[model samples]
Target: MRTSRDAPTRRIRAAVVGTGAIAAGSHLPALAALAAEGGLEVVAAVDVDTGAVQRFCADGGVPHGYTDLGRMLAEQRPDLVCICTPPTLHREQTVAALRAGAWVWCEKPPVPSLADFDAVEAEEGQEDDGGPYASIVFQHRFGSGARHVRRLIADGALGRPLVAHCQTTWYRDAAYYAVPWRGRWDTEGGGPAMGHGIHQTDLLLDLLGPWSEVRAMAGRLVHDVQTEDVSTALVRFGGGALATVVNSVLSPDEVSRIRIDCERATVELTHLYGHGNDNWRITPAPGVPAGEAAAWRDFGPDVPSSHLAQLRELVASMRAGQRPRSSGADGRTSLELVTALYKSAFTDTTVRAGDIGPGDPFYTALHGGAPGWAPAPATYEEASA
Candidate 1:
């Protein structure tokens, strides 16, 4: 791996923080693929646990390992940093990377709250200038299926998107929440709505555009965890479309789905974790020509939504010196939607897109001062015990 001093411009220096399952399972593999293509070099890995960091770096063939993120950033000065740390660390790590002049690709629930997200945003370079920007991992918005649907909706081929339903219902038992950060508000952010459902919800927002308001309900239906195990919301989009959202961890029939009822056709995606063109179906309204509907089904080659898909786009953006998707306003919009969902559920009032900001309590935390709503997460020691 050549350094920027001698390497071609397309081959960037990259690092990973947090040697957790996500870093190992998703981020590292994506980086490896990109590295094989000479797009970027995986230079270093960082973690709180020295042993874990060493194992991660050694097993992944990353050249350097450090226990401190600051030390790694200072030493390597990577051009891109993939942050797979827990939610609590996202804002700080992203800010640090951006401050170090590295572009950031942080995992979902980007930060615990809108304020933290905004704070990370403040560290970014201006749009016209070369970045040092922070991008969030919302990979569901990529792949050919999502792109096809988004283009159809945007071009009015799907006609006006009148109504939609988004669901992220996957089963998780007590053992799943055994991790210290898994069920905590202060750590993992919030339950399925923030940690799990944010993927599908972000894709929903990406396809449907800005949301006008949300009225939601959330509860701890099954798990003894501090956060809600289930949540539902009625969201109104700025374009006058309405969507019903259901996020849960108690479903036996596991699925992640988004169905939109448009004037000309009804488009739906049904899949578990990630989706491909095969998981998508488009049905034209009665009397609409089957030929026109066939054209709508042309999603081209299948590209399942994955870390690699979004990572490829990010690397391309880095090469072109352009802002990538799931960054800046796009990334913040998803976090804001999740925040408003929580606030609306807790307050039992409709919350708008701009309702939560610097002064708003929800802007700072998902709990948002709602009476008796603060979750007390178990300490790491207790969780491990």
Candidate 2:
């Protein structure tokens, strides 16, 4: 377990890899916030494209930037590394950082397949001296409303969890796919399901539990992409809890919502882009005893809204010699569900989570196998209409 004395006081030295959308939007801003408070420092930023890294640093007020990861790792030796690279590159970069004695907080989806995750796990196992711990970035878990809901479930205030419904509807214009890795199966992994939906999916797995089985269908409904623009799945949790996931990048408007139905009551949350916890609704079943209903209503205080909250927690854990709230193993569970969905879509059958292990043939085939999907046409009218 980590202790408070272990926390770095003179600013935690940090490095960032990749200069893409996520790096620019989420990770950079959060790290900048920490730097402003003197809690963290951005020591080095790296990208395969030097110009991109330099431009990002110029705009973000960062001083050091590099194109080669090895050179940066050898020279800077940052205490923490933030990997904002592509999905396929996560495993390799994470292992590289960890082996170099840097704690890694990488973006998701962690890896394209379970096989790759096994390789990362193997690398982690070889480390005898415990210095830097590794974790995955599932920032949605830090959202105030999500954390409150998790606490309520833990306290048994919601009673037995029976069912959950999650909807992730976000728009991705044709120009969004114009980028080389935007919607490609081999490069970006999967489309909306793996990219956007993975956030909510990770939250679902975090709040509920590991899924036991999954049956899913995916298709290129709108975007000109090699993966699904829209997908749906029916999931069965370990304790027989049922859930449904609806993810789409083709929706006309964007909205993210989750509804959990418990034995005693139900809770619903609706948060639009840029509107975190400002909008939420909780409704209990009718005809319930007033006392229980009131207790449920007064169970807790409102949660705060901040993406940096989890990062703070991670730093605290490192100081206290404890594991972060969401460890690499926990992060892998959501990815496992994603892999299972892809496998189910390809086989046209239900897939059990345990059946898709590292040694499974389906799991191994996913590494080099081409996605059985094609991109939609440039114009929706030309393709669908």
Candidate 3:
């Protein structure tokens, strides 16, 4: 029997860890809006930098700030905890929150390695008994445009999936990596492929389902960071579709594009950062009806996919005692793809779906337990920038 506990009307008490750009720019604002509507309350914030946390709370109207995560968890007892810290810090913080009886919402590149992600996943409540669960911020999958096309594909309006291409080619100059954690393997994980490209590619995986194999290569083409600035991969999906993926921080004219060719039509979305209905287009294959193509592009009620969209869904799912989309299991798909890409690039071999597991070195580190390339020399201005 369903009870009142299944549909919470009481506002969700929330706390945020890490006061970085992503927290300030995306999470905080969305949370603030939700709080304004009486759906959530920003109870506390945690950051290693006390001053940053203080400023974040003051500016965002949060009630409390703490320098330590454990202290915040103990004192606030929040219903939802947002882990906005760097990838390296994600595992410990997420596990701590889940064990503390709070549902967690974490940023992308959820953890530095698959082992760490699994460790965090193990702490969550099992099955539907859900008092606590965690979700990764893969907002690209929540947009109405992507939602519309995904429906079309599922309904057989798009027919059999055939081939596809996805790209995350955006430039981040030396100044961008000047931050201490920007490019190191231990810190930011694996450069553009892990940090930047994972967003679009996660959406691709969401649309296409499980990938079967990947052949790839990565290199430090321009940036002085320890990780690669560019990477390219050829992927084979379980649904009998093929794809070419490219991740690069060296391109001047930035764009995020994904094009899928199906037996009935070709669907494409092109935009940088966030996307709207205008950014998506569809073309019917030869001899196919023109009306289907028009209906494909006619996504109703333009909801630009963003952090807020996903966050709203996460909160609602928690209220309903349900594990939200992009749960640990859902997120592992994209992270597994990242692991496979790194393994393939470094080993000079094609990597299969289950090739990387407990025994594999790539399971622990994206670099396969090998030492990474030394950071290139930076000019004084570049270093200071």
Candidate 4:
């Protein structure tokens, strides 16, 4: 085999938990690409459903299949594990993998609550240990457009950000919630706010730094789900920027959009789920130069936002013996924002950073331990047809 001056790193052993939609659609494909390039091997697959595991392993070319996560962890002893399960299962599966001496790549909504998320983060070891770190898949922040915009802000091209708006308005009929874990507070955390819109909102938070406070409201408007199908919030950033956030699963012409008004220009990104350069636009403030406006839209290389982009970075970080981007701490920012939004919405009051800590009811449950809204009477066929 051809080799570089430095010895090539061994292929990292990897396992996957949950043989579901996200695993098939995103994570599995990304892992397969990495495996093909000789960075890692998909050593094991685990799921509660035996049939699902069998099919996933066969289809994905994973070497071993197991029904029990513990068994897979022990037998395969993978260096990395992908927790592609539901939000509720993420904490348990991640902690187990960490304890088993594997770094974890977890899907978004890493845990249902801040209390649980902190617990999982605690399982990660210090940097010197070459540890058992966990990286959350917040892929939207990895795209070239986002990277270019971030550089613009850093270079004072956009000037101080003044105001912003974020929207994740998508449609999901009652049939979509037929899946057992789809909309319940206990299993899925919150509704569109937690599950669907989280991607855009996380990207919003990624661009704007820390937030100071939020006032929000949520309602179980259309779907019969236990959580809110639509919600809105007004946020105050520590940097003095104010943003309005809206999340809904009711719009037919679904779109994820975020617009930021800065001193020099107005920057906007619009797309559903993921984005490429075409989704971004910049309008300069009246006094700003046209050249700067043109430069804003000229993101050099094209990199679309996707799981594969993040996975490549995660694998590279592992090889460099560094904690990956969107590590536990980085992910907690978005989770904390979610928790605070729930606290503000449910209570009809302002919620600040550090307000939803250990003893706060919102820390453990998004609904503050209150009983979730009972699912309204609705049938999947009736809604779908």
| Model 2 ranges off by over 4 Å | 1-10, 125-131, 287-306, 364-371, 374-385
Q: Best candidate, lDDT-wise?
A: 1
For model 4, residues 1-385, the per-residue Cα lDDT tens digits are: 1111122388888888999999989999989998999888899999999999999999998889999999898889888899988888989999998888788999988789989988988998777755568988899999788888888876788999999999999999878999998888778888888898888888888898889999998888778777888999999999999999999999999999999999989999998989999899999989877786787879988999999889888877777667787887788888888888888887778999888888888888888865454334469988988
Please provide, for model 3 over 86-132, each residue's C-alpha lDDT reduced to its tens digit, 9 standing for 90 to 100.
Answer: 99899999989988888899998889988888888888886667658
Clashing pairs in 1: none
For model 4, give the 10-residue run with minimal summed lDDT: 1-10
* Model 1 Cα lDDT, one tens digit per residue, 198-283: 99999999999999999999998789887899999999999999999999999999999999999999999999989999999998
Residue 377 lDDT, candidate 4, scale 0-100 = 46
- lDDT, each prediction: 0.89, 0.76, 0.88, 0.86
Off by over 4 Å in 1: 1-10, 376-385
Collision pairs in model 3: none
Give one digit per residue, the lDDT tens place, for model 2 in 6-79. 55465678899999888889888888888888788898899999899999899888788999998998998887
Which model, 1 or 3, shows the larger TM-score?
1
Tell me the lDDT of model 3 at 308: 88
RMSD for each of the candidates: 3.2, 5.2, 4.1, 5.1
Predicted structure 3: lDDT: 0.88
Ranking by lDDT: 1, 3, 4, 2
Order of candidate numbers by TM-score, starting with the best: 1, 3, 4, 2
